[model samples]
Target: MLLLLCLSVLSQAAKAQETWEVFMEKIPEHLQVSLLIQDEEGQTLFSQSADKRIPSASIIKIPILIALMEKVENREITLDARYSLQATDKVGGAGELQHLPDGSGITFRYLAEEMIRISDNTATNILIRAIEMGYIQDWLKKNGYRDTQLNRLMMDFKAIEEGRQNYTSPREINDILLNLWEGKWLKEDSRAEIMHCLKGCADNSTIPSLLPAGTVVAHKTGTLDYVRGDAGIILGDKPLILSVFVENFESMEEAESAIGKIALKAFRDFGR
Candidate 1:
């Protein structure tokens, strides 16, 4: 009995070592990586640094979408509410809406879709400015999300890239996605619409590219060089909510590839 117990303990240790090794090796040396996978049935399959605080990049839009949906839920904003493009709202990087002529107008709902699906910088800031930053802050505090916030509009210049205000963690973003998809964010239809929009997200660099093509993942990708992030719901034969945030990568591709490796691991292990 003693010898058998010793062998069992050794096996457990070896398994733990392997788990840590996957994270340590696939995450890249000296990079900050937070990976979390929660079965889509609403159970956490894997979590590490999933909640660890880190820079959000475009992943911040996940919360921004929630805030906007709250406005819709409260009847504070209408789906058809028309918004005109503002020069001040435009931010450089990752989107084309900024360069479109100022006369273009879109509905509040469409803005939310564009912002989350494409990580459209201009659309995100515009919606945030519409809801007012304070509203988003208050919503975060009221909800279960303790570590998510937008330090500024997508491109406040002084705040996100150079300022101390902009940052978030993998766990927070994952929770946001889970709540959004779990039908907890808004009325039934509203929640469905939000998830539907996120499902259409165009940036498929991280989780989307890594998973089986038919697998439905409603996720967004964030990148600011050395830092790359993707957080969303991964629906396979068995669904899961996952967040993979990598910082200090050598390049955008490196960070993205790191995320792909971790996601592939989860898919293999959790789905099997």
Candidate 2:
């Protein structure tokens, strides 16, 4: 058994080395990359600028989902509870809520699903209202995510212009997924519910684009004019918790392609 473990360690180290070389060679010069990958045992297989804070885009919704789940687990909120969408609630971005009629009532569960699955902007704002932003910020800080902050709601262009954007580090988000995968800080059922939401994510343009078909990846993706980020848990021979973020890209397609290549390298190396 000890010899087998030693072989596995050596294999992982070699894979990391190869992946590092690939990244250094292929990643474009215009973008900044932050990433972290961990095996099931919580050993970091690869990392680069993992501690740097960057704009979160819609990925900040993950923390919001976590806070909402905690509220549900504590009996402070009910998933079936409905909230009415005002004309003011509608915001433009990646979701169907903006197209829905005003005064339509949606349940917390449905809104949460939309937020993660489609990266819904309006659904996200409704959730922020349901579970106040203060609680979300407090939860992230109390949970040891020092670099993540929820400072503004989705589609708040004014806030963005004011420099009050949401932010998170690759390391912090990867750790969040690791905890969720292991059911460490949350009850198993709560963690399961969160994972269920994550699995519904529809944006397959980044990490999932290059992964083999039908790979079980429960993840969230965030995008902006110049930023792209994807983080998730990939179930394999040795489950991988991978986070990849690229910022300041000249184009989003290039950013996503870079992330896909990075994720594919890790998947091939560690998953095999």
What TM-score against the true fold does each predicted structure earn? 0.87, 0.93
Candidate 2 whole-model C-alpha lDDT, 0 to 1: 0.88
What would the per-residue lDDT of candidate 2 be over residues 61-122, giving only the tens digit for each residue?
88899899999989988999988889999999799999988889899999999999999999
**Candidate 1's error at 152, in angstroms?**
0.6
lDDT of 1 by residue, 1-272 (tens): 99999999789757855785676674567777777777766666666776687777887787777778778888988979888887876788777788888878888888888887777888887887788988888888788666786667776666655665656777677677767767776788788777788788888878877777688877887877557888877777777788888876777887777778777777877764
- Scored by TM-score, the top model is 2
Note the Cα lDDT for every prediction shown: 0.77, 0.88
- What is the clash tally of candidate 1? 3
**In model 2, where is the ten-residue run with the lowest total lDDT?**
16-25
